[model samples]
Target chain A: MRISPTDVAQVMTLLHDDPEFRFLILSDLCGVDTGSVMQVVYHLWSDATPDWLRVIVDGLPREDPRAPSVTFLWNGAEWAEREAYDMFGIIFEGNRDLRRIYMPPDYQSFPLRKDFLLADDAARSPGQGVRHMEQTFQPAEYRRTPVLRQGLGSDAGHMAPGIQTAELASGEDPAR
Target chain B: MTTEQTVRSLDDPDLFVETPGTIYDAIPPLPPRTEREAEFYTMRDGEMLINLGPQHPSTHGVLRVVLKIDGERVVDLDPVLGYLHRGVEKICENGDWHHAISNCDPLEYIAAMFSEAMPVMVAEKLLDLGVPRRAEYIRVLAWELNRISSHALFVGWLALDLGGLTPILYGFIERDEIVEMLAALTGQRLLFNYLRIGGVNGDLNHDFLSRLGDWMGNALKRIEDQQKLLNSNEIFVARTRGLGVIDRDLARRTLLSGPVLRATGIPYDVRRAHPYSVYPELEFTIPTREEGDSYARYLLHLDEIKQSIHIIDQVLHRMPDGPVMAKVPRLMRVPPGRAYVSIESPRGQYSAYGMSDGSDQPFRLRIHDPSFFNLQAVGLLMPGNLVADTMAIMASVDPIMGGVDK
Candidate 1:
């Protein structure tokens, strides 16, 4: 069902009351900026059905962003709300605990916000210790180890260039 | 919202080893919180705080579950992740479109095809490019094989979790074959950076098809053999029969997808309801379970494997001869817009949310990993279960850690 911003409160209540949507799990809440302002998108799913609902609730001042938390419905929303806080600078009212999820707690600007820019010096080597991504800092000269693979009964590609039984290499039976 | 110290015992090590004597090396069971769990029982009369892992073998991938239990039952379960979170989304955000595909390989390493495709499919939608029929077929082929292999791992892992060892060996016996097949075609066994922006990075030759077809022919029998082994084992049935019983109401509310949602008897296959690639034209059945228990969920995978094999048989027969790529502008620029796309992975429904500011790289990209959403569900399934059956239920839910904590 297509819902409006005015109906966000009612929808949140329906998420709790409606047996199908109760538990009110908000799978993802991310900001999508059409141009000037970003539209807040909420992806919700049913605990019973193999289905999900995409709910779009706009929270755009691009400055003083705020949206009511659905944490009351599902406890899982606590962390999701924290991620939203760090990425979009969106304040989740009534959120049980709001801290930066991916970034350090003292971080300033939200990396996911459309206007956020990467620092200058890190341009030449994108893999360098550019701010925000520290623990996963890989240098420019890094080369991934190449993968070697082969199929059974066929020499279409490189097969490690060794003498092993065809079926044994494929992990299948030679009898087959 | 809780990082309770009560989950630990004074004698417990932060990281103690499970399966101490075995080669498998599983994590040891969490020590019972007799004194504190008793207080949690007295205070809430219903609120129970139980731990799921850091040691749990079901998905020993740094997964932990905090459950609010109400006397042999789970009132609410909140999943604790970030243990395996490498900030893959953050990594993807900085890299260009091409660079991102390589990074996507590790998101859900088990079903690397789906993980890799999740972003590529969205990029295609954003770039407004047509995927060559050959590439779509190749994707369908690789994806189905990956689906089967992942399902095999699930079946085997479930067996291992439920105290059965035979099925796992049989399942991996088949997995090694498929991994070899993928390795030959994509040049990488686990991470296939084979899918490029406009088209595939390579072609699907004769040997790949024949090898894949051989596995497809025998995988159905393997599933059949597993069913025989499990169906005959009374212990397997008893432990898994009604343990971790999931109600349809909770299943629908949580938006459970894949086999778990199917195990609850809902036909919400992304391939069926929202058919992508050649799923619409191809023939396959959507497996379902009415009981909504671990056994029904367990039986559902056996059925799903059959369906995947059936789809692969068609993919092999209708192997249309053509180029595996489409022509496109070298420098891609997606016009300002947004598109949310999903694929029914072996685990559940995996989706990607893409936005572009009329640029080559997306202005904002968010990957809604299925395991991330599905892992939250362990809270719902873990309650009312024995400390041992926790892993069994986890296997039934099938949370791939890479996907869960990505």
Candidate 2:
């Protein structure tokens, strides 16, 4: 079932405290980043009953994503909330230690965000294509010629200055 | 520039001493607001800090816990994790259904079959597909075998942590035998990517079955021998019994699962609670103990091994001969929906939550690892216990950092 960010704490209380629901365990608390919004998913399972309840708090604003913390109800939510905060930047309100769980505390970006680019991607210049092939074939002839860089060009035989390219011990073609 | 100036500079308090108005000086002191916070902030005379591993052997893996000890008794503990995080959840979201199975293999490396089974089951549920009867039986067989190996290692590791070496050696003997059997069936011993989308990758051959039967005959007796070796030992009983006790309420509140939860007198087994695959068809009982201590948890592991063996034997008896896999498309495009599938893993309830947007890849994949939850109880179990008892408590919890950090 889907609930609003405002209703998360109350519903969690009802699910946990109410005798009928009795969802004693907070199995998982994960965050999903859609293009426009963040969805904090809570999976609750009961010890006495077989019911697995999913409480999804959808439509948290993208720029400032925040959800009410359920740590007070379930201490296990502490780490799970920290993990969500670390990965998706969804702040869990009322969580005392809302620091990063998977990433370093000083880490600036949430890697799980859809728009977050990896540090490796920042190294490439505009129009600088992929460095490695997505998938390589066994045959060398079918392989695409790698784009050479300035200061390290084809004239250098793809070797940087001061580095020598050795011939194969068999004295065969380098490609072979 | 001169020798006199150099001597003067070296002696100067201004040059030698750290400045008062630096970054460290700019921070304001925190005043405790709550009664509990006040106690934590105030350091009693005997209280001192001990940082135990992101590298300690007793910690099992790369887990660091900052423990505040009041002499021999632990006053507080703060477990620091994420040393082994590899962004597994994000990787699962980016990868296709087939890739997700292989990616999740390392989460619970001790029982690779259970870890693999969770994702496959969730994907199957999301796709609304039923596995073949033969495949379900094969999955049960593999899962039970993996559980035995995992529990065997735990038995050894727990004993080793408590300063016993022979049990771990015996544990490894059983584990190696099962792993060899698994390798013959799955090709990989440690991280077996055997479970596919709708079914398993391979069928159980005659050789594998015969060997499994061979192992089964002596497996319980061997485990019993292991129990007798440790359970009756005066030191083992003294170290484990009445130490690191977790009551039934605390166990449920902390969300401890699997054998640890069962040890607290709650017979909540996911296999029985939410029956999946061929488990519902199989006949096995959930064992519970009222002791709720380290010894009870150890006994629970032995009992569980027996129960798992029973389940596997039942699978062998009702083994069906047919196609192993249900017909699945090459590119499995799971329908837009959400599903959570959990199984009774070695440590606890290992669950996989998947959300699909009608794409070949999952929109989001969340692994609700049991170790991650069970590790939380350490905070409750550590305080007021002897400093040495911390190792015993953590061992009883039996967290796999691969699953905890992931």
Candidate 3:
């Protein structure tokens, strides 16, 4: 679901407090870059059932990406949040030890971003300064972006305008 | 001297100051406040920093756990990972959906079946592909076989870590038998890329089934012989019994699962709780021990192996005969959606979270490895124990650095 970055910590706290929706384990917390914006995805799972709830906070400004951290709620989120920050350069507010995980401490750019160029691939060949693959080597249809779907809303799992919630089944404690 | 003259004088050889020895020897030792440290000078301010391994055998893989110790107890601990990081998630994002199955084979190298199955199941979920009944049965059969072998290796390694050599050799015997069976079924021994997106790579044959049946019949006796070798040994019990007792709350807080969590009295098993594949039809118990110690965790491995054998027996009897692979396209494109599919791996609840942007390749592929999370509990388990007990606690956790670093 798409939510404001400001409300992420509060919403996570609310979900954690709810007896009906026991999202006890923070299964995974990761971030993605969608051209114009950065989106942070949080996957929560209840131990009792097969249900998993996904919470997405999208449309964070690309220039200064920041989201509230949930380490205080789930201690396991400590490393996961650091990893998210490491990959996407999205700062997790209030993370005491928010350090780079996979990448080196002095890494200049987030490697996962669409615009970031790999060092090896970015270097020009001996004689060919800047050569682009011609039409003869056009990539497959699936490799190219499909006629741009109705923006990030449709791209991030049919998530409605804001705070959308869906489940595999009903009566299994739907999130508020 | 003037400020400019003073700065320039620092470069003059006459004014230069030199320590008597190398850089490390130049620093003087800190003053000791207690009798424990009064006898000798310590490396840091009252604490010693020890790097356990990036190359030590007991660590099981390339995992470097820095331990800060005061006397014989651990004062602080920090695990340094990424020694084996191959950017697997990023690699999966760039590759086609079908090829990514092979890419994930090394994440949990000890039990490659579970790691390989995760991406396949997630892609299957995203595409809404229904695996054949026979294929599901085959998957469970292979998965159980892999689980038994992985646990066998763990039991042997635990004994080896606690300074006993014979149990590990016996462990190799059991593990070799299971691996030989799996290798015959799936063309590879360690990283079997046998499981594909739609279904498994191939079907079980008569030769494989007969051999597996014979092995399954005597598997319990072999496992028991291994348990008897180490379970009652006075030294083994003394070292591991109450060495690292992680309670239920700490296990939950640390996000521990599988045997470690089961050892703490939680009867949570992803296969039983979530009921993935053909696990719903099969009946087996999720073994739990109230002790929440290394000994309990060790016993849990033995108990769980027996349960896996029971599951294999059920699969063998109710084996269906049909097409193994579903009709998947040459190049598969998953619809724009997000799905998280988890299986009860030998270590814990190993999950694959795939986000597809209606492309042949995934936009992002995040793997929630159980060993990666379970390894975190070492900090809680290692604080009060003696220095020697560190090996026992780490062995009990059974962390595979391939999974942890990935």
Cα deviation of A35, candidate 3, in Å? 3.1
Candidate 1 accuracy as lDDT: 0.68
DockQ for every prediction shown? 0.04, 0.12, 0.10
By DockQ rank, best first, the candidates go 2, 3, 1
Error of 2 at B64 (Å): 0.8
- TM-score values for chain B across all models: 0.85, 0.91, 0.89
Best-to-worst order by lDDT is: 2, 3, 1
Better of 2 and 3 by DockQ: 2
Q: What is the TM-score of each candidate against the true structure?
A: 0.75, 0.84, 0.83
Local accuracy of candidate 3 as per-residue lDDT tens digits, B251-368: 7767788899999998888887778898889999999999999999999999999999998889989999999999999889899988988889999989888889998988878888
**CAPRI category for model 1:** incorrect
Better of 1 and 3 by DockQ: 3
lDDT of each: 0.68, 0.80, 0.77
DockQ, computed on Cα atoms, for candidate 1: 0.04
Candidate 3 chain A lowest-lDDT run of ten: A133-142
Q: Flag the better candidate by TM-score, 2 or 3.
A: 2
